[model samples]
Target: MQNDYMIVKEGGHSIALENGVFYNPKMKGLRDISVAFLKAAGAGGTTLLDSTSATGIRGIRYSDSGVAGLTFLDISEKASENTKRNVKRNNLEGISRVFNKSIQEFAHTREKFDIIDLDPFGSPMPYMNDIMKLSKGGTIMMVTATDTAVLCGAHPKACIKSYDSRPLHNELCKEVGIRILMGYAIRIAAKFNFGVDVLMVLSDMHYMRIFYRIRAGAENAVASMKEGGFGTYCNSCGSFGYSKGIAPVFQQACSNCGKRLEAFGPLYLGRLYDKRITGKILENLEDGNARKIIEVINDELDIPFFYNIPKITKLRRVGSASPAGIMSALGNAGHRCSPTQFSHSSIKTAAGIKAVEKALRSAKDFRLRAR
Candidate 1:
């Protein structure tokens, strides 16, 4: 019966998913992500963890990938039980362990792992420190942030409160949303004394997501957000774009139409991918052991936007055709924004410009309220 859910292979190896289980379509792509990391680690087996093993699929696959051991954990009792069942069925009862416990309880203890994964439902905001607890040197943390729309600078204050960082929206590509989320998550991780390196960044079907391969220690990993700057975006009719390395000027109105422009703050540029790791993973993707999933690895490696830009956290884009217009608008407003991302649904010129003016007024309200 298990075979029905699995694709059995030549050596009697198989891949299967539990029936009536929690499955995000991103789950499949997630599998690809884990495999890529494992291949990059350059070991037969590594001590890998699925911090929130939703269906235990990631943990199970880790064990199957010639990993020496796997620790599958889930707050959900059913998920832990499901992991146990799958491990048993796959004959991984020996090296794979599943636990139903609070991540905080686990974090309070001393346990170091080669990889500590956190794929929580929405934000991993709750578990940043616990993740640090389990990690030592060179620890790779696979983090997934699925609450993309909110984190994509759609709402500056909301994204800030939720992620504890800023978000920069990119309008040129549909992927700007997820990139914004990843950028925010990275900045937050940095504030906690660990540097977040994006191992993989991807977007698909209403979901903007990323897999961060994080390690402890803030130095040598990335440039601190202290020195970083922001990007402003324009939201005008058909001429959407972004500007960088400058302040937003309020007086900057849309050249297309002599109307005021909405200015989102200096959003960060998310650029923390490890170039060596990214390349090494692609180079050593194959051996006699795996021929089945090579295509996925190759496809991911070829993404155009995959680059290692350092020290930036998040970048925001509203919809300006040129970055100058965006920066000009923000600068004129006499409003100071963090280097992190910020965007409101407001636009540039006329109706959109009115929204921008309104946003400035609100920021003032927030500042006054703080006092």
Candidate 2:
């Protein structure tokens, strides 16, 4: 109706997806989360750069949420035109500027932003260096990568080439993928002498998103690098462990089943979520789906990797066990545990595999007795 393409509504805003422009309807939840995060971080009166603004929905919503100044950038001219239209339709033209140029080009300008959102079509690896050039102290960077296959270890060689880290091709792949991303970004930022404070991370659907704040200083960069390490997995027993440092002496065999352990990393081994920032986002959040995801993320244990209950149950041949029941059993044993947002059938807990297996057996037995 507005242009050559159809008009669609998302996050309560109508956007025109012009022909040849890229816009994904499935990313609405992520856009909603972005708006909430901006509001929570007091992004009002600050400038924002939507580096891959397709239809400009994200930047427009951010403007509505009180972001004072906005710059929408896209490589396609059609995308830039569509964003311009959406800005006007939303009455945000007064505060928004649209540019048809690559982010690398824009980075050459003296303009810096308080927030930089990079939601590219695939890996954000190419733009990480330029992105750091547009950041100042305390700048918030929101990055999204949809190359799930590469990062999740379906293409191990590709991950190594792109992220400079190895990935696990198993039940723990999603979490490992996220850590690899964090590690990659931290390393890139460190090159610019900017350290990252991870605010939150999400591995939803087919993509992974991370929100982090950039802090300036060589000491801070070194501190962030200290969080980089390697992870060892026991494919035989579904057990995994991580050690902080570039080269950690890993146990040769699985501690649970005595099978050989495989190493995967040069990945991040730090807290994935900063509870304070997460709490702020929750306080400002209103979307149901975003709220549910954030609540789970808020409660997720700060452990490195999670266990897939289905995989564990099948491996141990202990019959089926419920995730809630397993959590209850672990809690009863004084071990802290919580469900991870990465997978419904998985959980993050400090309890070792033996303890987890014992809890699973007990829970299974209890279920059989009740039945």
Candidate 3:
């Protein structure tokens, strides 16, 4: 049992991990980002709830960041005991509480949390309604979905069943996954006449995390619903376009190429991350990978899809061109271009596929001439 006391360092806090309780070292960047987000957003008057706390690392970290208070809730007695130990170990008895019961038990209770963090082992979809009920106006809810396949259209049926939205799998699959998750959250919150303002979203290494601020009222709910839309992608030409609203009509042929287009969505097509909050998060990040992720996110266009330069070059049978040179060429041609966080070699630009192909060919021709 002593071996279960393995100490783990995460963000600005340290905790002892239990044998059966989950504590992934790989998720350290996520924890650090959460901490930075809280600092930037100002966790005011918020009683934080780590709804799926296994080892209590997240709750303890939030408490250490001076959140008003936090409740560490877990269904496992082993995890509950470990949470108590970690709370005591960190000397945070005054502002921390441990509960060993299914989070659903709290649904009936009048008690509500200003911030409820759901980092479950799998899909958070099943618990969405109950958590929506537990949220009050102005509540901040954070959710993590590890079912990338379901959210990314690898399993279209499951994605539709779970999130009630169609997903796209391609170069922009990660962004589609994020949007699918966001669409689900918005719709779930709308059931309770609560609207969500997405604060931060991340798709890092096999999981997608989202933070939202809930606003109460039927009007806000309708406004949030309006953000839902669908994407039409042309497999033949790599051309894609999005139509706003739930009922979207897809053209029979691709606008750029005369090939049939495949449709994906009924998902959120709005902005993924708040620019101001992301800028602040970038300032607090110490890890290179996390900083780079945020930096790319900050630079990415609010558009739906990004084109992988390598894939584009391969499609054209031209020599590979640097992403930087392609972006520079596109920018010079009076088009907005930026690298996407989803793929390092990809660019999200207003330039059409034809324009991109031209840019790539021009860059290659210039390089050959110089040599």
Candidate 4:
């Protein structure tokens, strides 16, 4: 089992697909999950866009799933060409179409899709608005963000810059990372007059994946998101921390022992896993390989509760902004990198979440005092 190849058999058919071209456990598992969801949704005859169509694996997978209108896009000529060949090889010639252009350019104003998927190597932040706009009626958004720093609350400033929310850099707020990521994706949907309801979410190591049911809403969602606060988990020994839901989480020391705790602010504070959806999807995973992986997911879900930590590296930061661009430059550039050095002052508190007005007022006061 080297990185040299993968043999992906098409369903129960005798067809076999092989090459070093596309191979990843997570990608394969997630593709199957999406299929299960669409089947359960009982929604057919819809459009799907694979914005970052790496090797066209996702696009092909979706087509094979029986999703009606599938559009696969890639910035590279070679990549898109490969996608075309794969589609033809799989006999999905008419069902799927591959595009040679950046998703930024291909996601057009005139085009509306039923589902738009963004699985960039890192952050999917910048393209949120575009994804929302392209989704017509009630489009489903499936976002995969592997850059945990912004989601986990590692770089608070960076999180705010990309997601318009803060991360709670702690162990307990595993839900915080997913929520923050969801909140940001929702807000992006909102801007295009798309309201968001998180249909399902699976927050795993190194990445946070979300499936959203998006609709129209401009004012309501934005007003709700402007509120902010710190997300906190125990800094000393990684214990269960709290989300004050009040702005200004870092103004005080740890509640447990007065020790300074690491916190991310106002990251969407809530539960991460959904048992119902996870169960349904797993139930549909009847195939041997898919069932095997689905069992692992089921086990993780069955656990009472677990730690939530952000997984981001220096290199991943750049991936969010431009995944296709980065990949072309370095085919496989990502490797384990050192975690960000945590400082004592980096810990935050929950008050930063309770009231944004108070937090902003404090910021203004700080500016005034400096003057």
TM-score per prediction, in order, is 0.62, 0.95, 0.94, 0.67
**Local error of candidate 3 at 30, Å?**
0.6
Worst 10 residues of 1 by lDDT: 306-315
Model 3, span 1-371: residue lDDT tens = 67647887776577888788888989988888888788777785569989899989898888745688888889999999999999998888988889998878877674778888999987999889888777899888889999999998899899988887778878778888888899989988989998889887888898999999999999999889888888888776677788777676667788776878888877887777788888888777886788888888887787777888877666555677899998888887888999887788888987778787667766666332220
Candidate 4 global lDDT: 0.56
**Which pairs of residues collide in model 2?**
none
TM-score ranking, best first: 2, 3, 4, 1
Ranking by lDDT: 2, 3, 4, 1
Cα lDDT for residue 279, candidate 2: 81
List per-prediction Cα lDDT, in the order shown.
0.52, 0.88, 0.83, 0.56
Q: Show model 1 residue runs off by greater than 4 Å.
A: 1-20, 41-43, 153-157, 164-176, 215-218, 226-228, 237-371
lDDT of 1 by residue, 107-221 (tens): 8776888777777877766787677678766667667666666666666577767754455554423334444455455566666666665655544444444555555676723
- Top lDDT hit: 2
Model 1 error, position 328 (Å):
31
Worst 10 residues of 2 by lDDT: 362-371
Expressed as tens digits, the lDDT of each residue in 1-371 for candidate 2 is 54478889887788888888887777788888888888877797999999999889888888756778999999988889889999998888888899999999988995889999999989999999998999998999999999999999999999999999999999888889999999999999999898899988998888899999999998899899999999999877789888897566778888777889999988999989888877888887775887899999888898788889999877765577789999999999998999998889988888788788778877777332210
Better of 2 and 3 by TM-score: 2
In terms of lDDT, the poorest run of 10 residues in model 4 is: 336-345
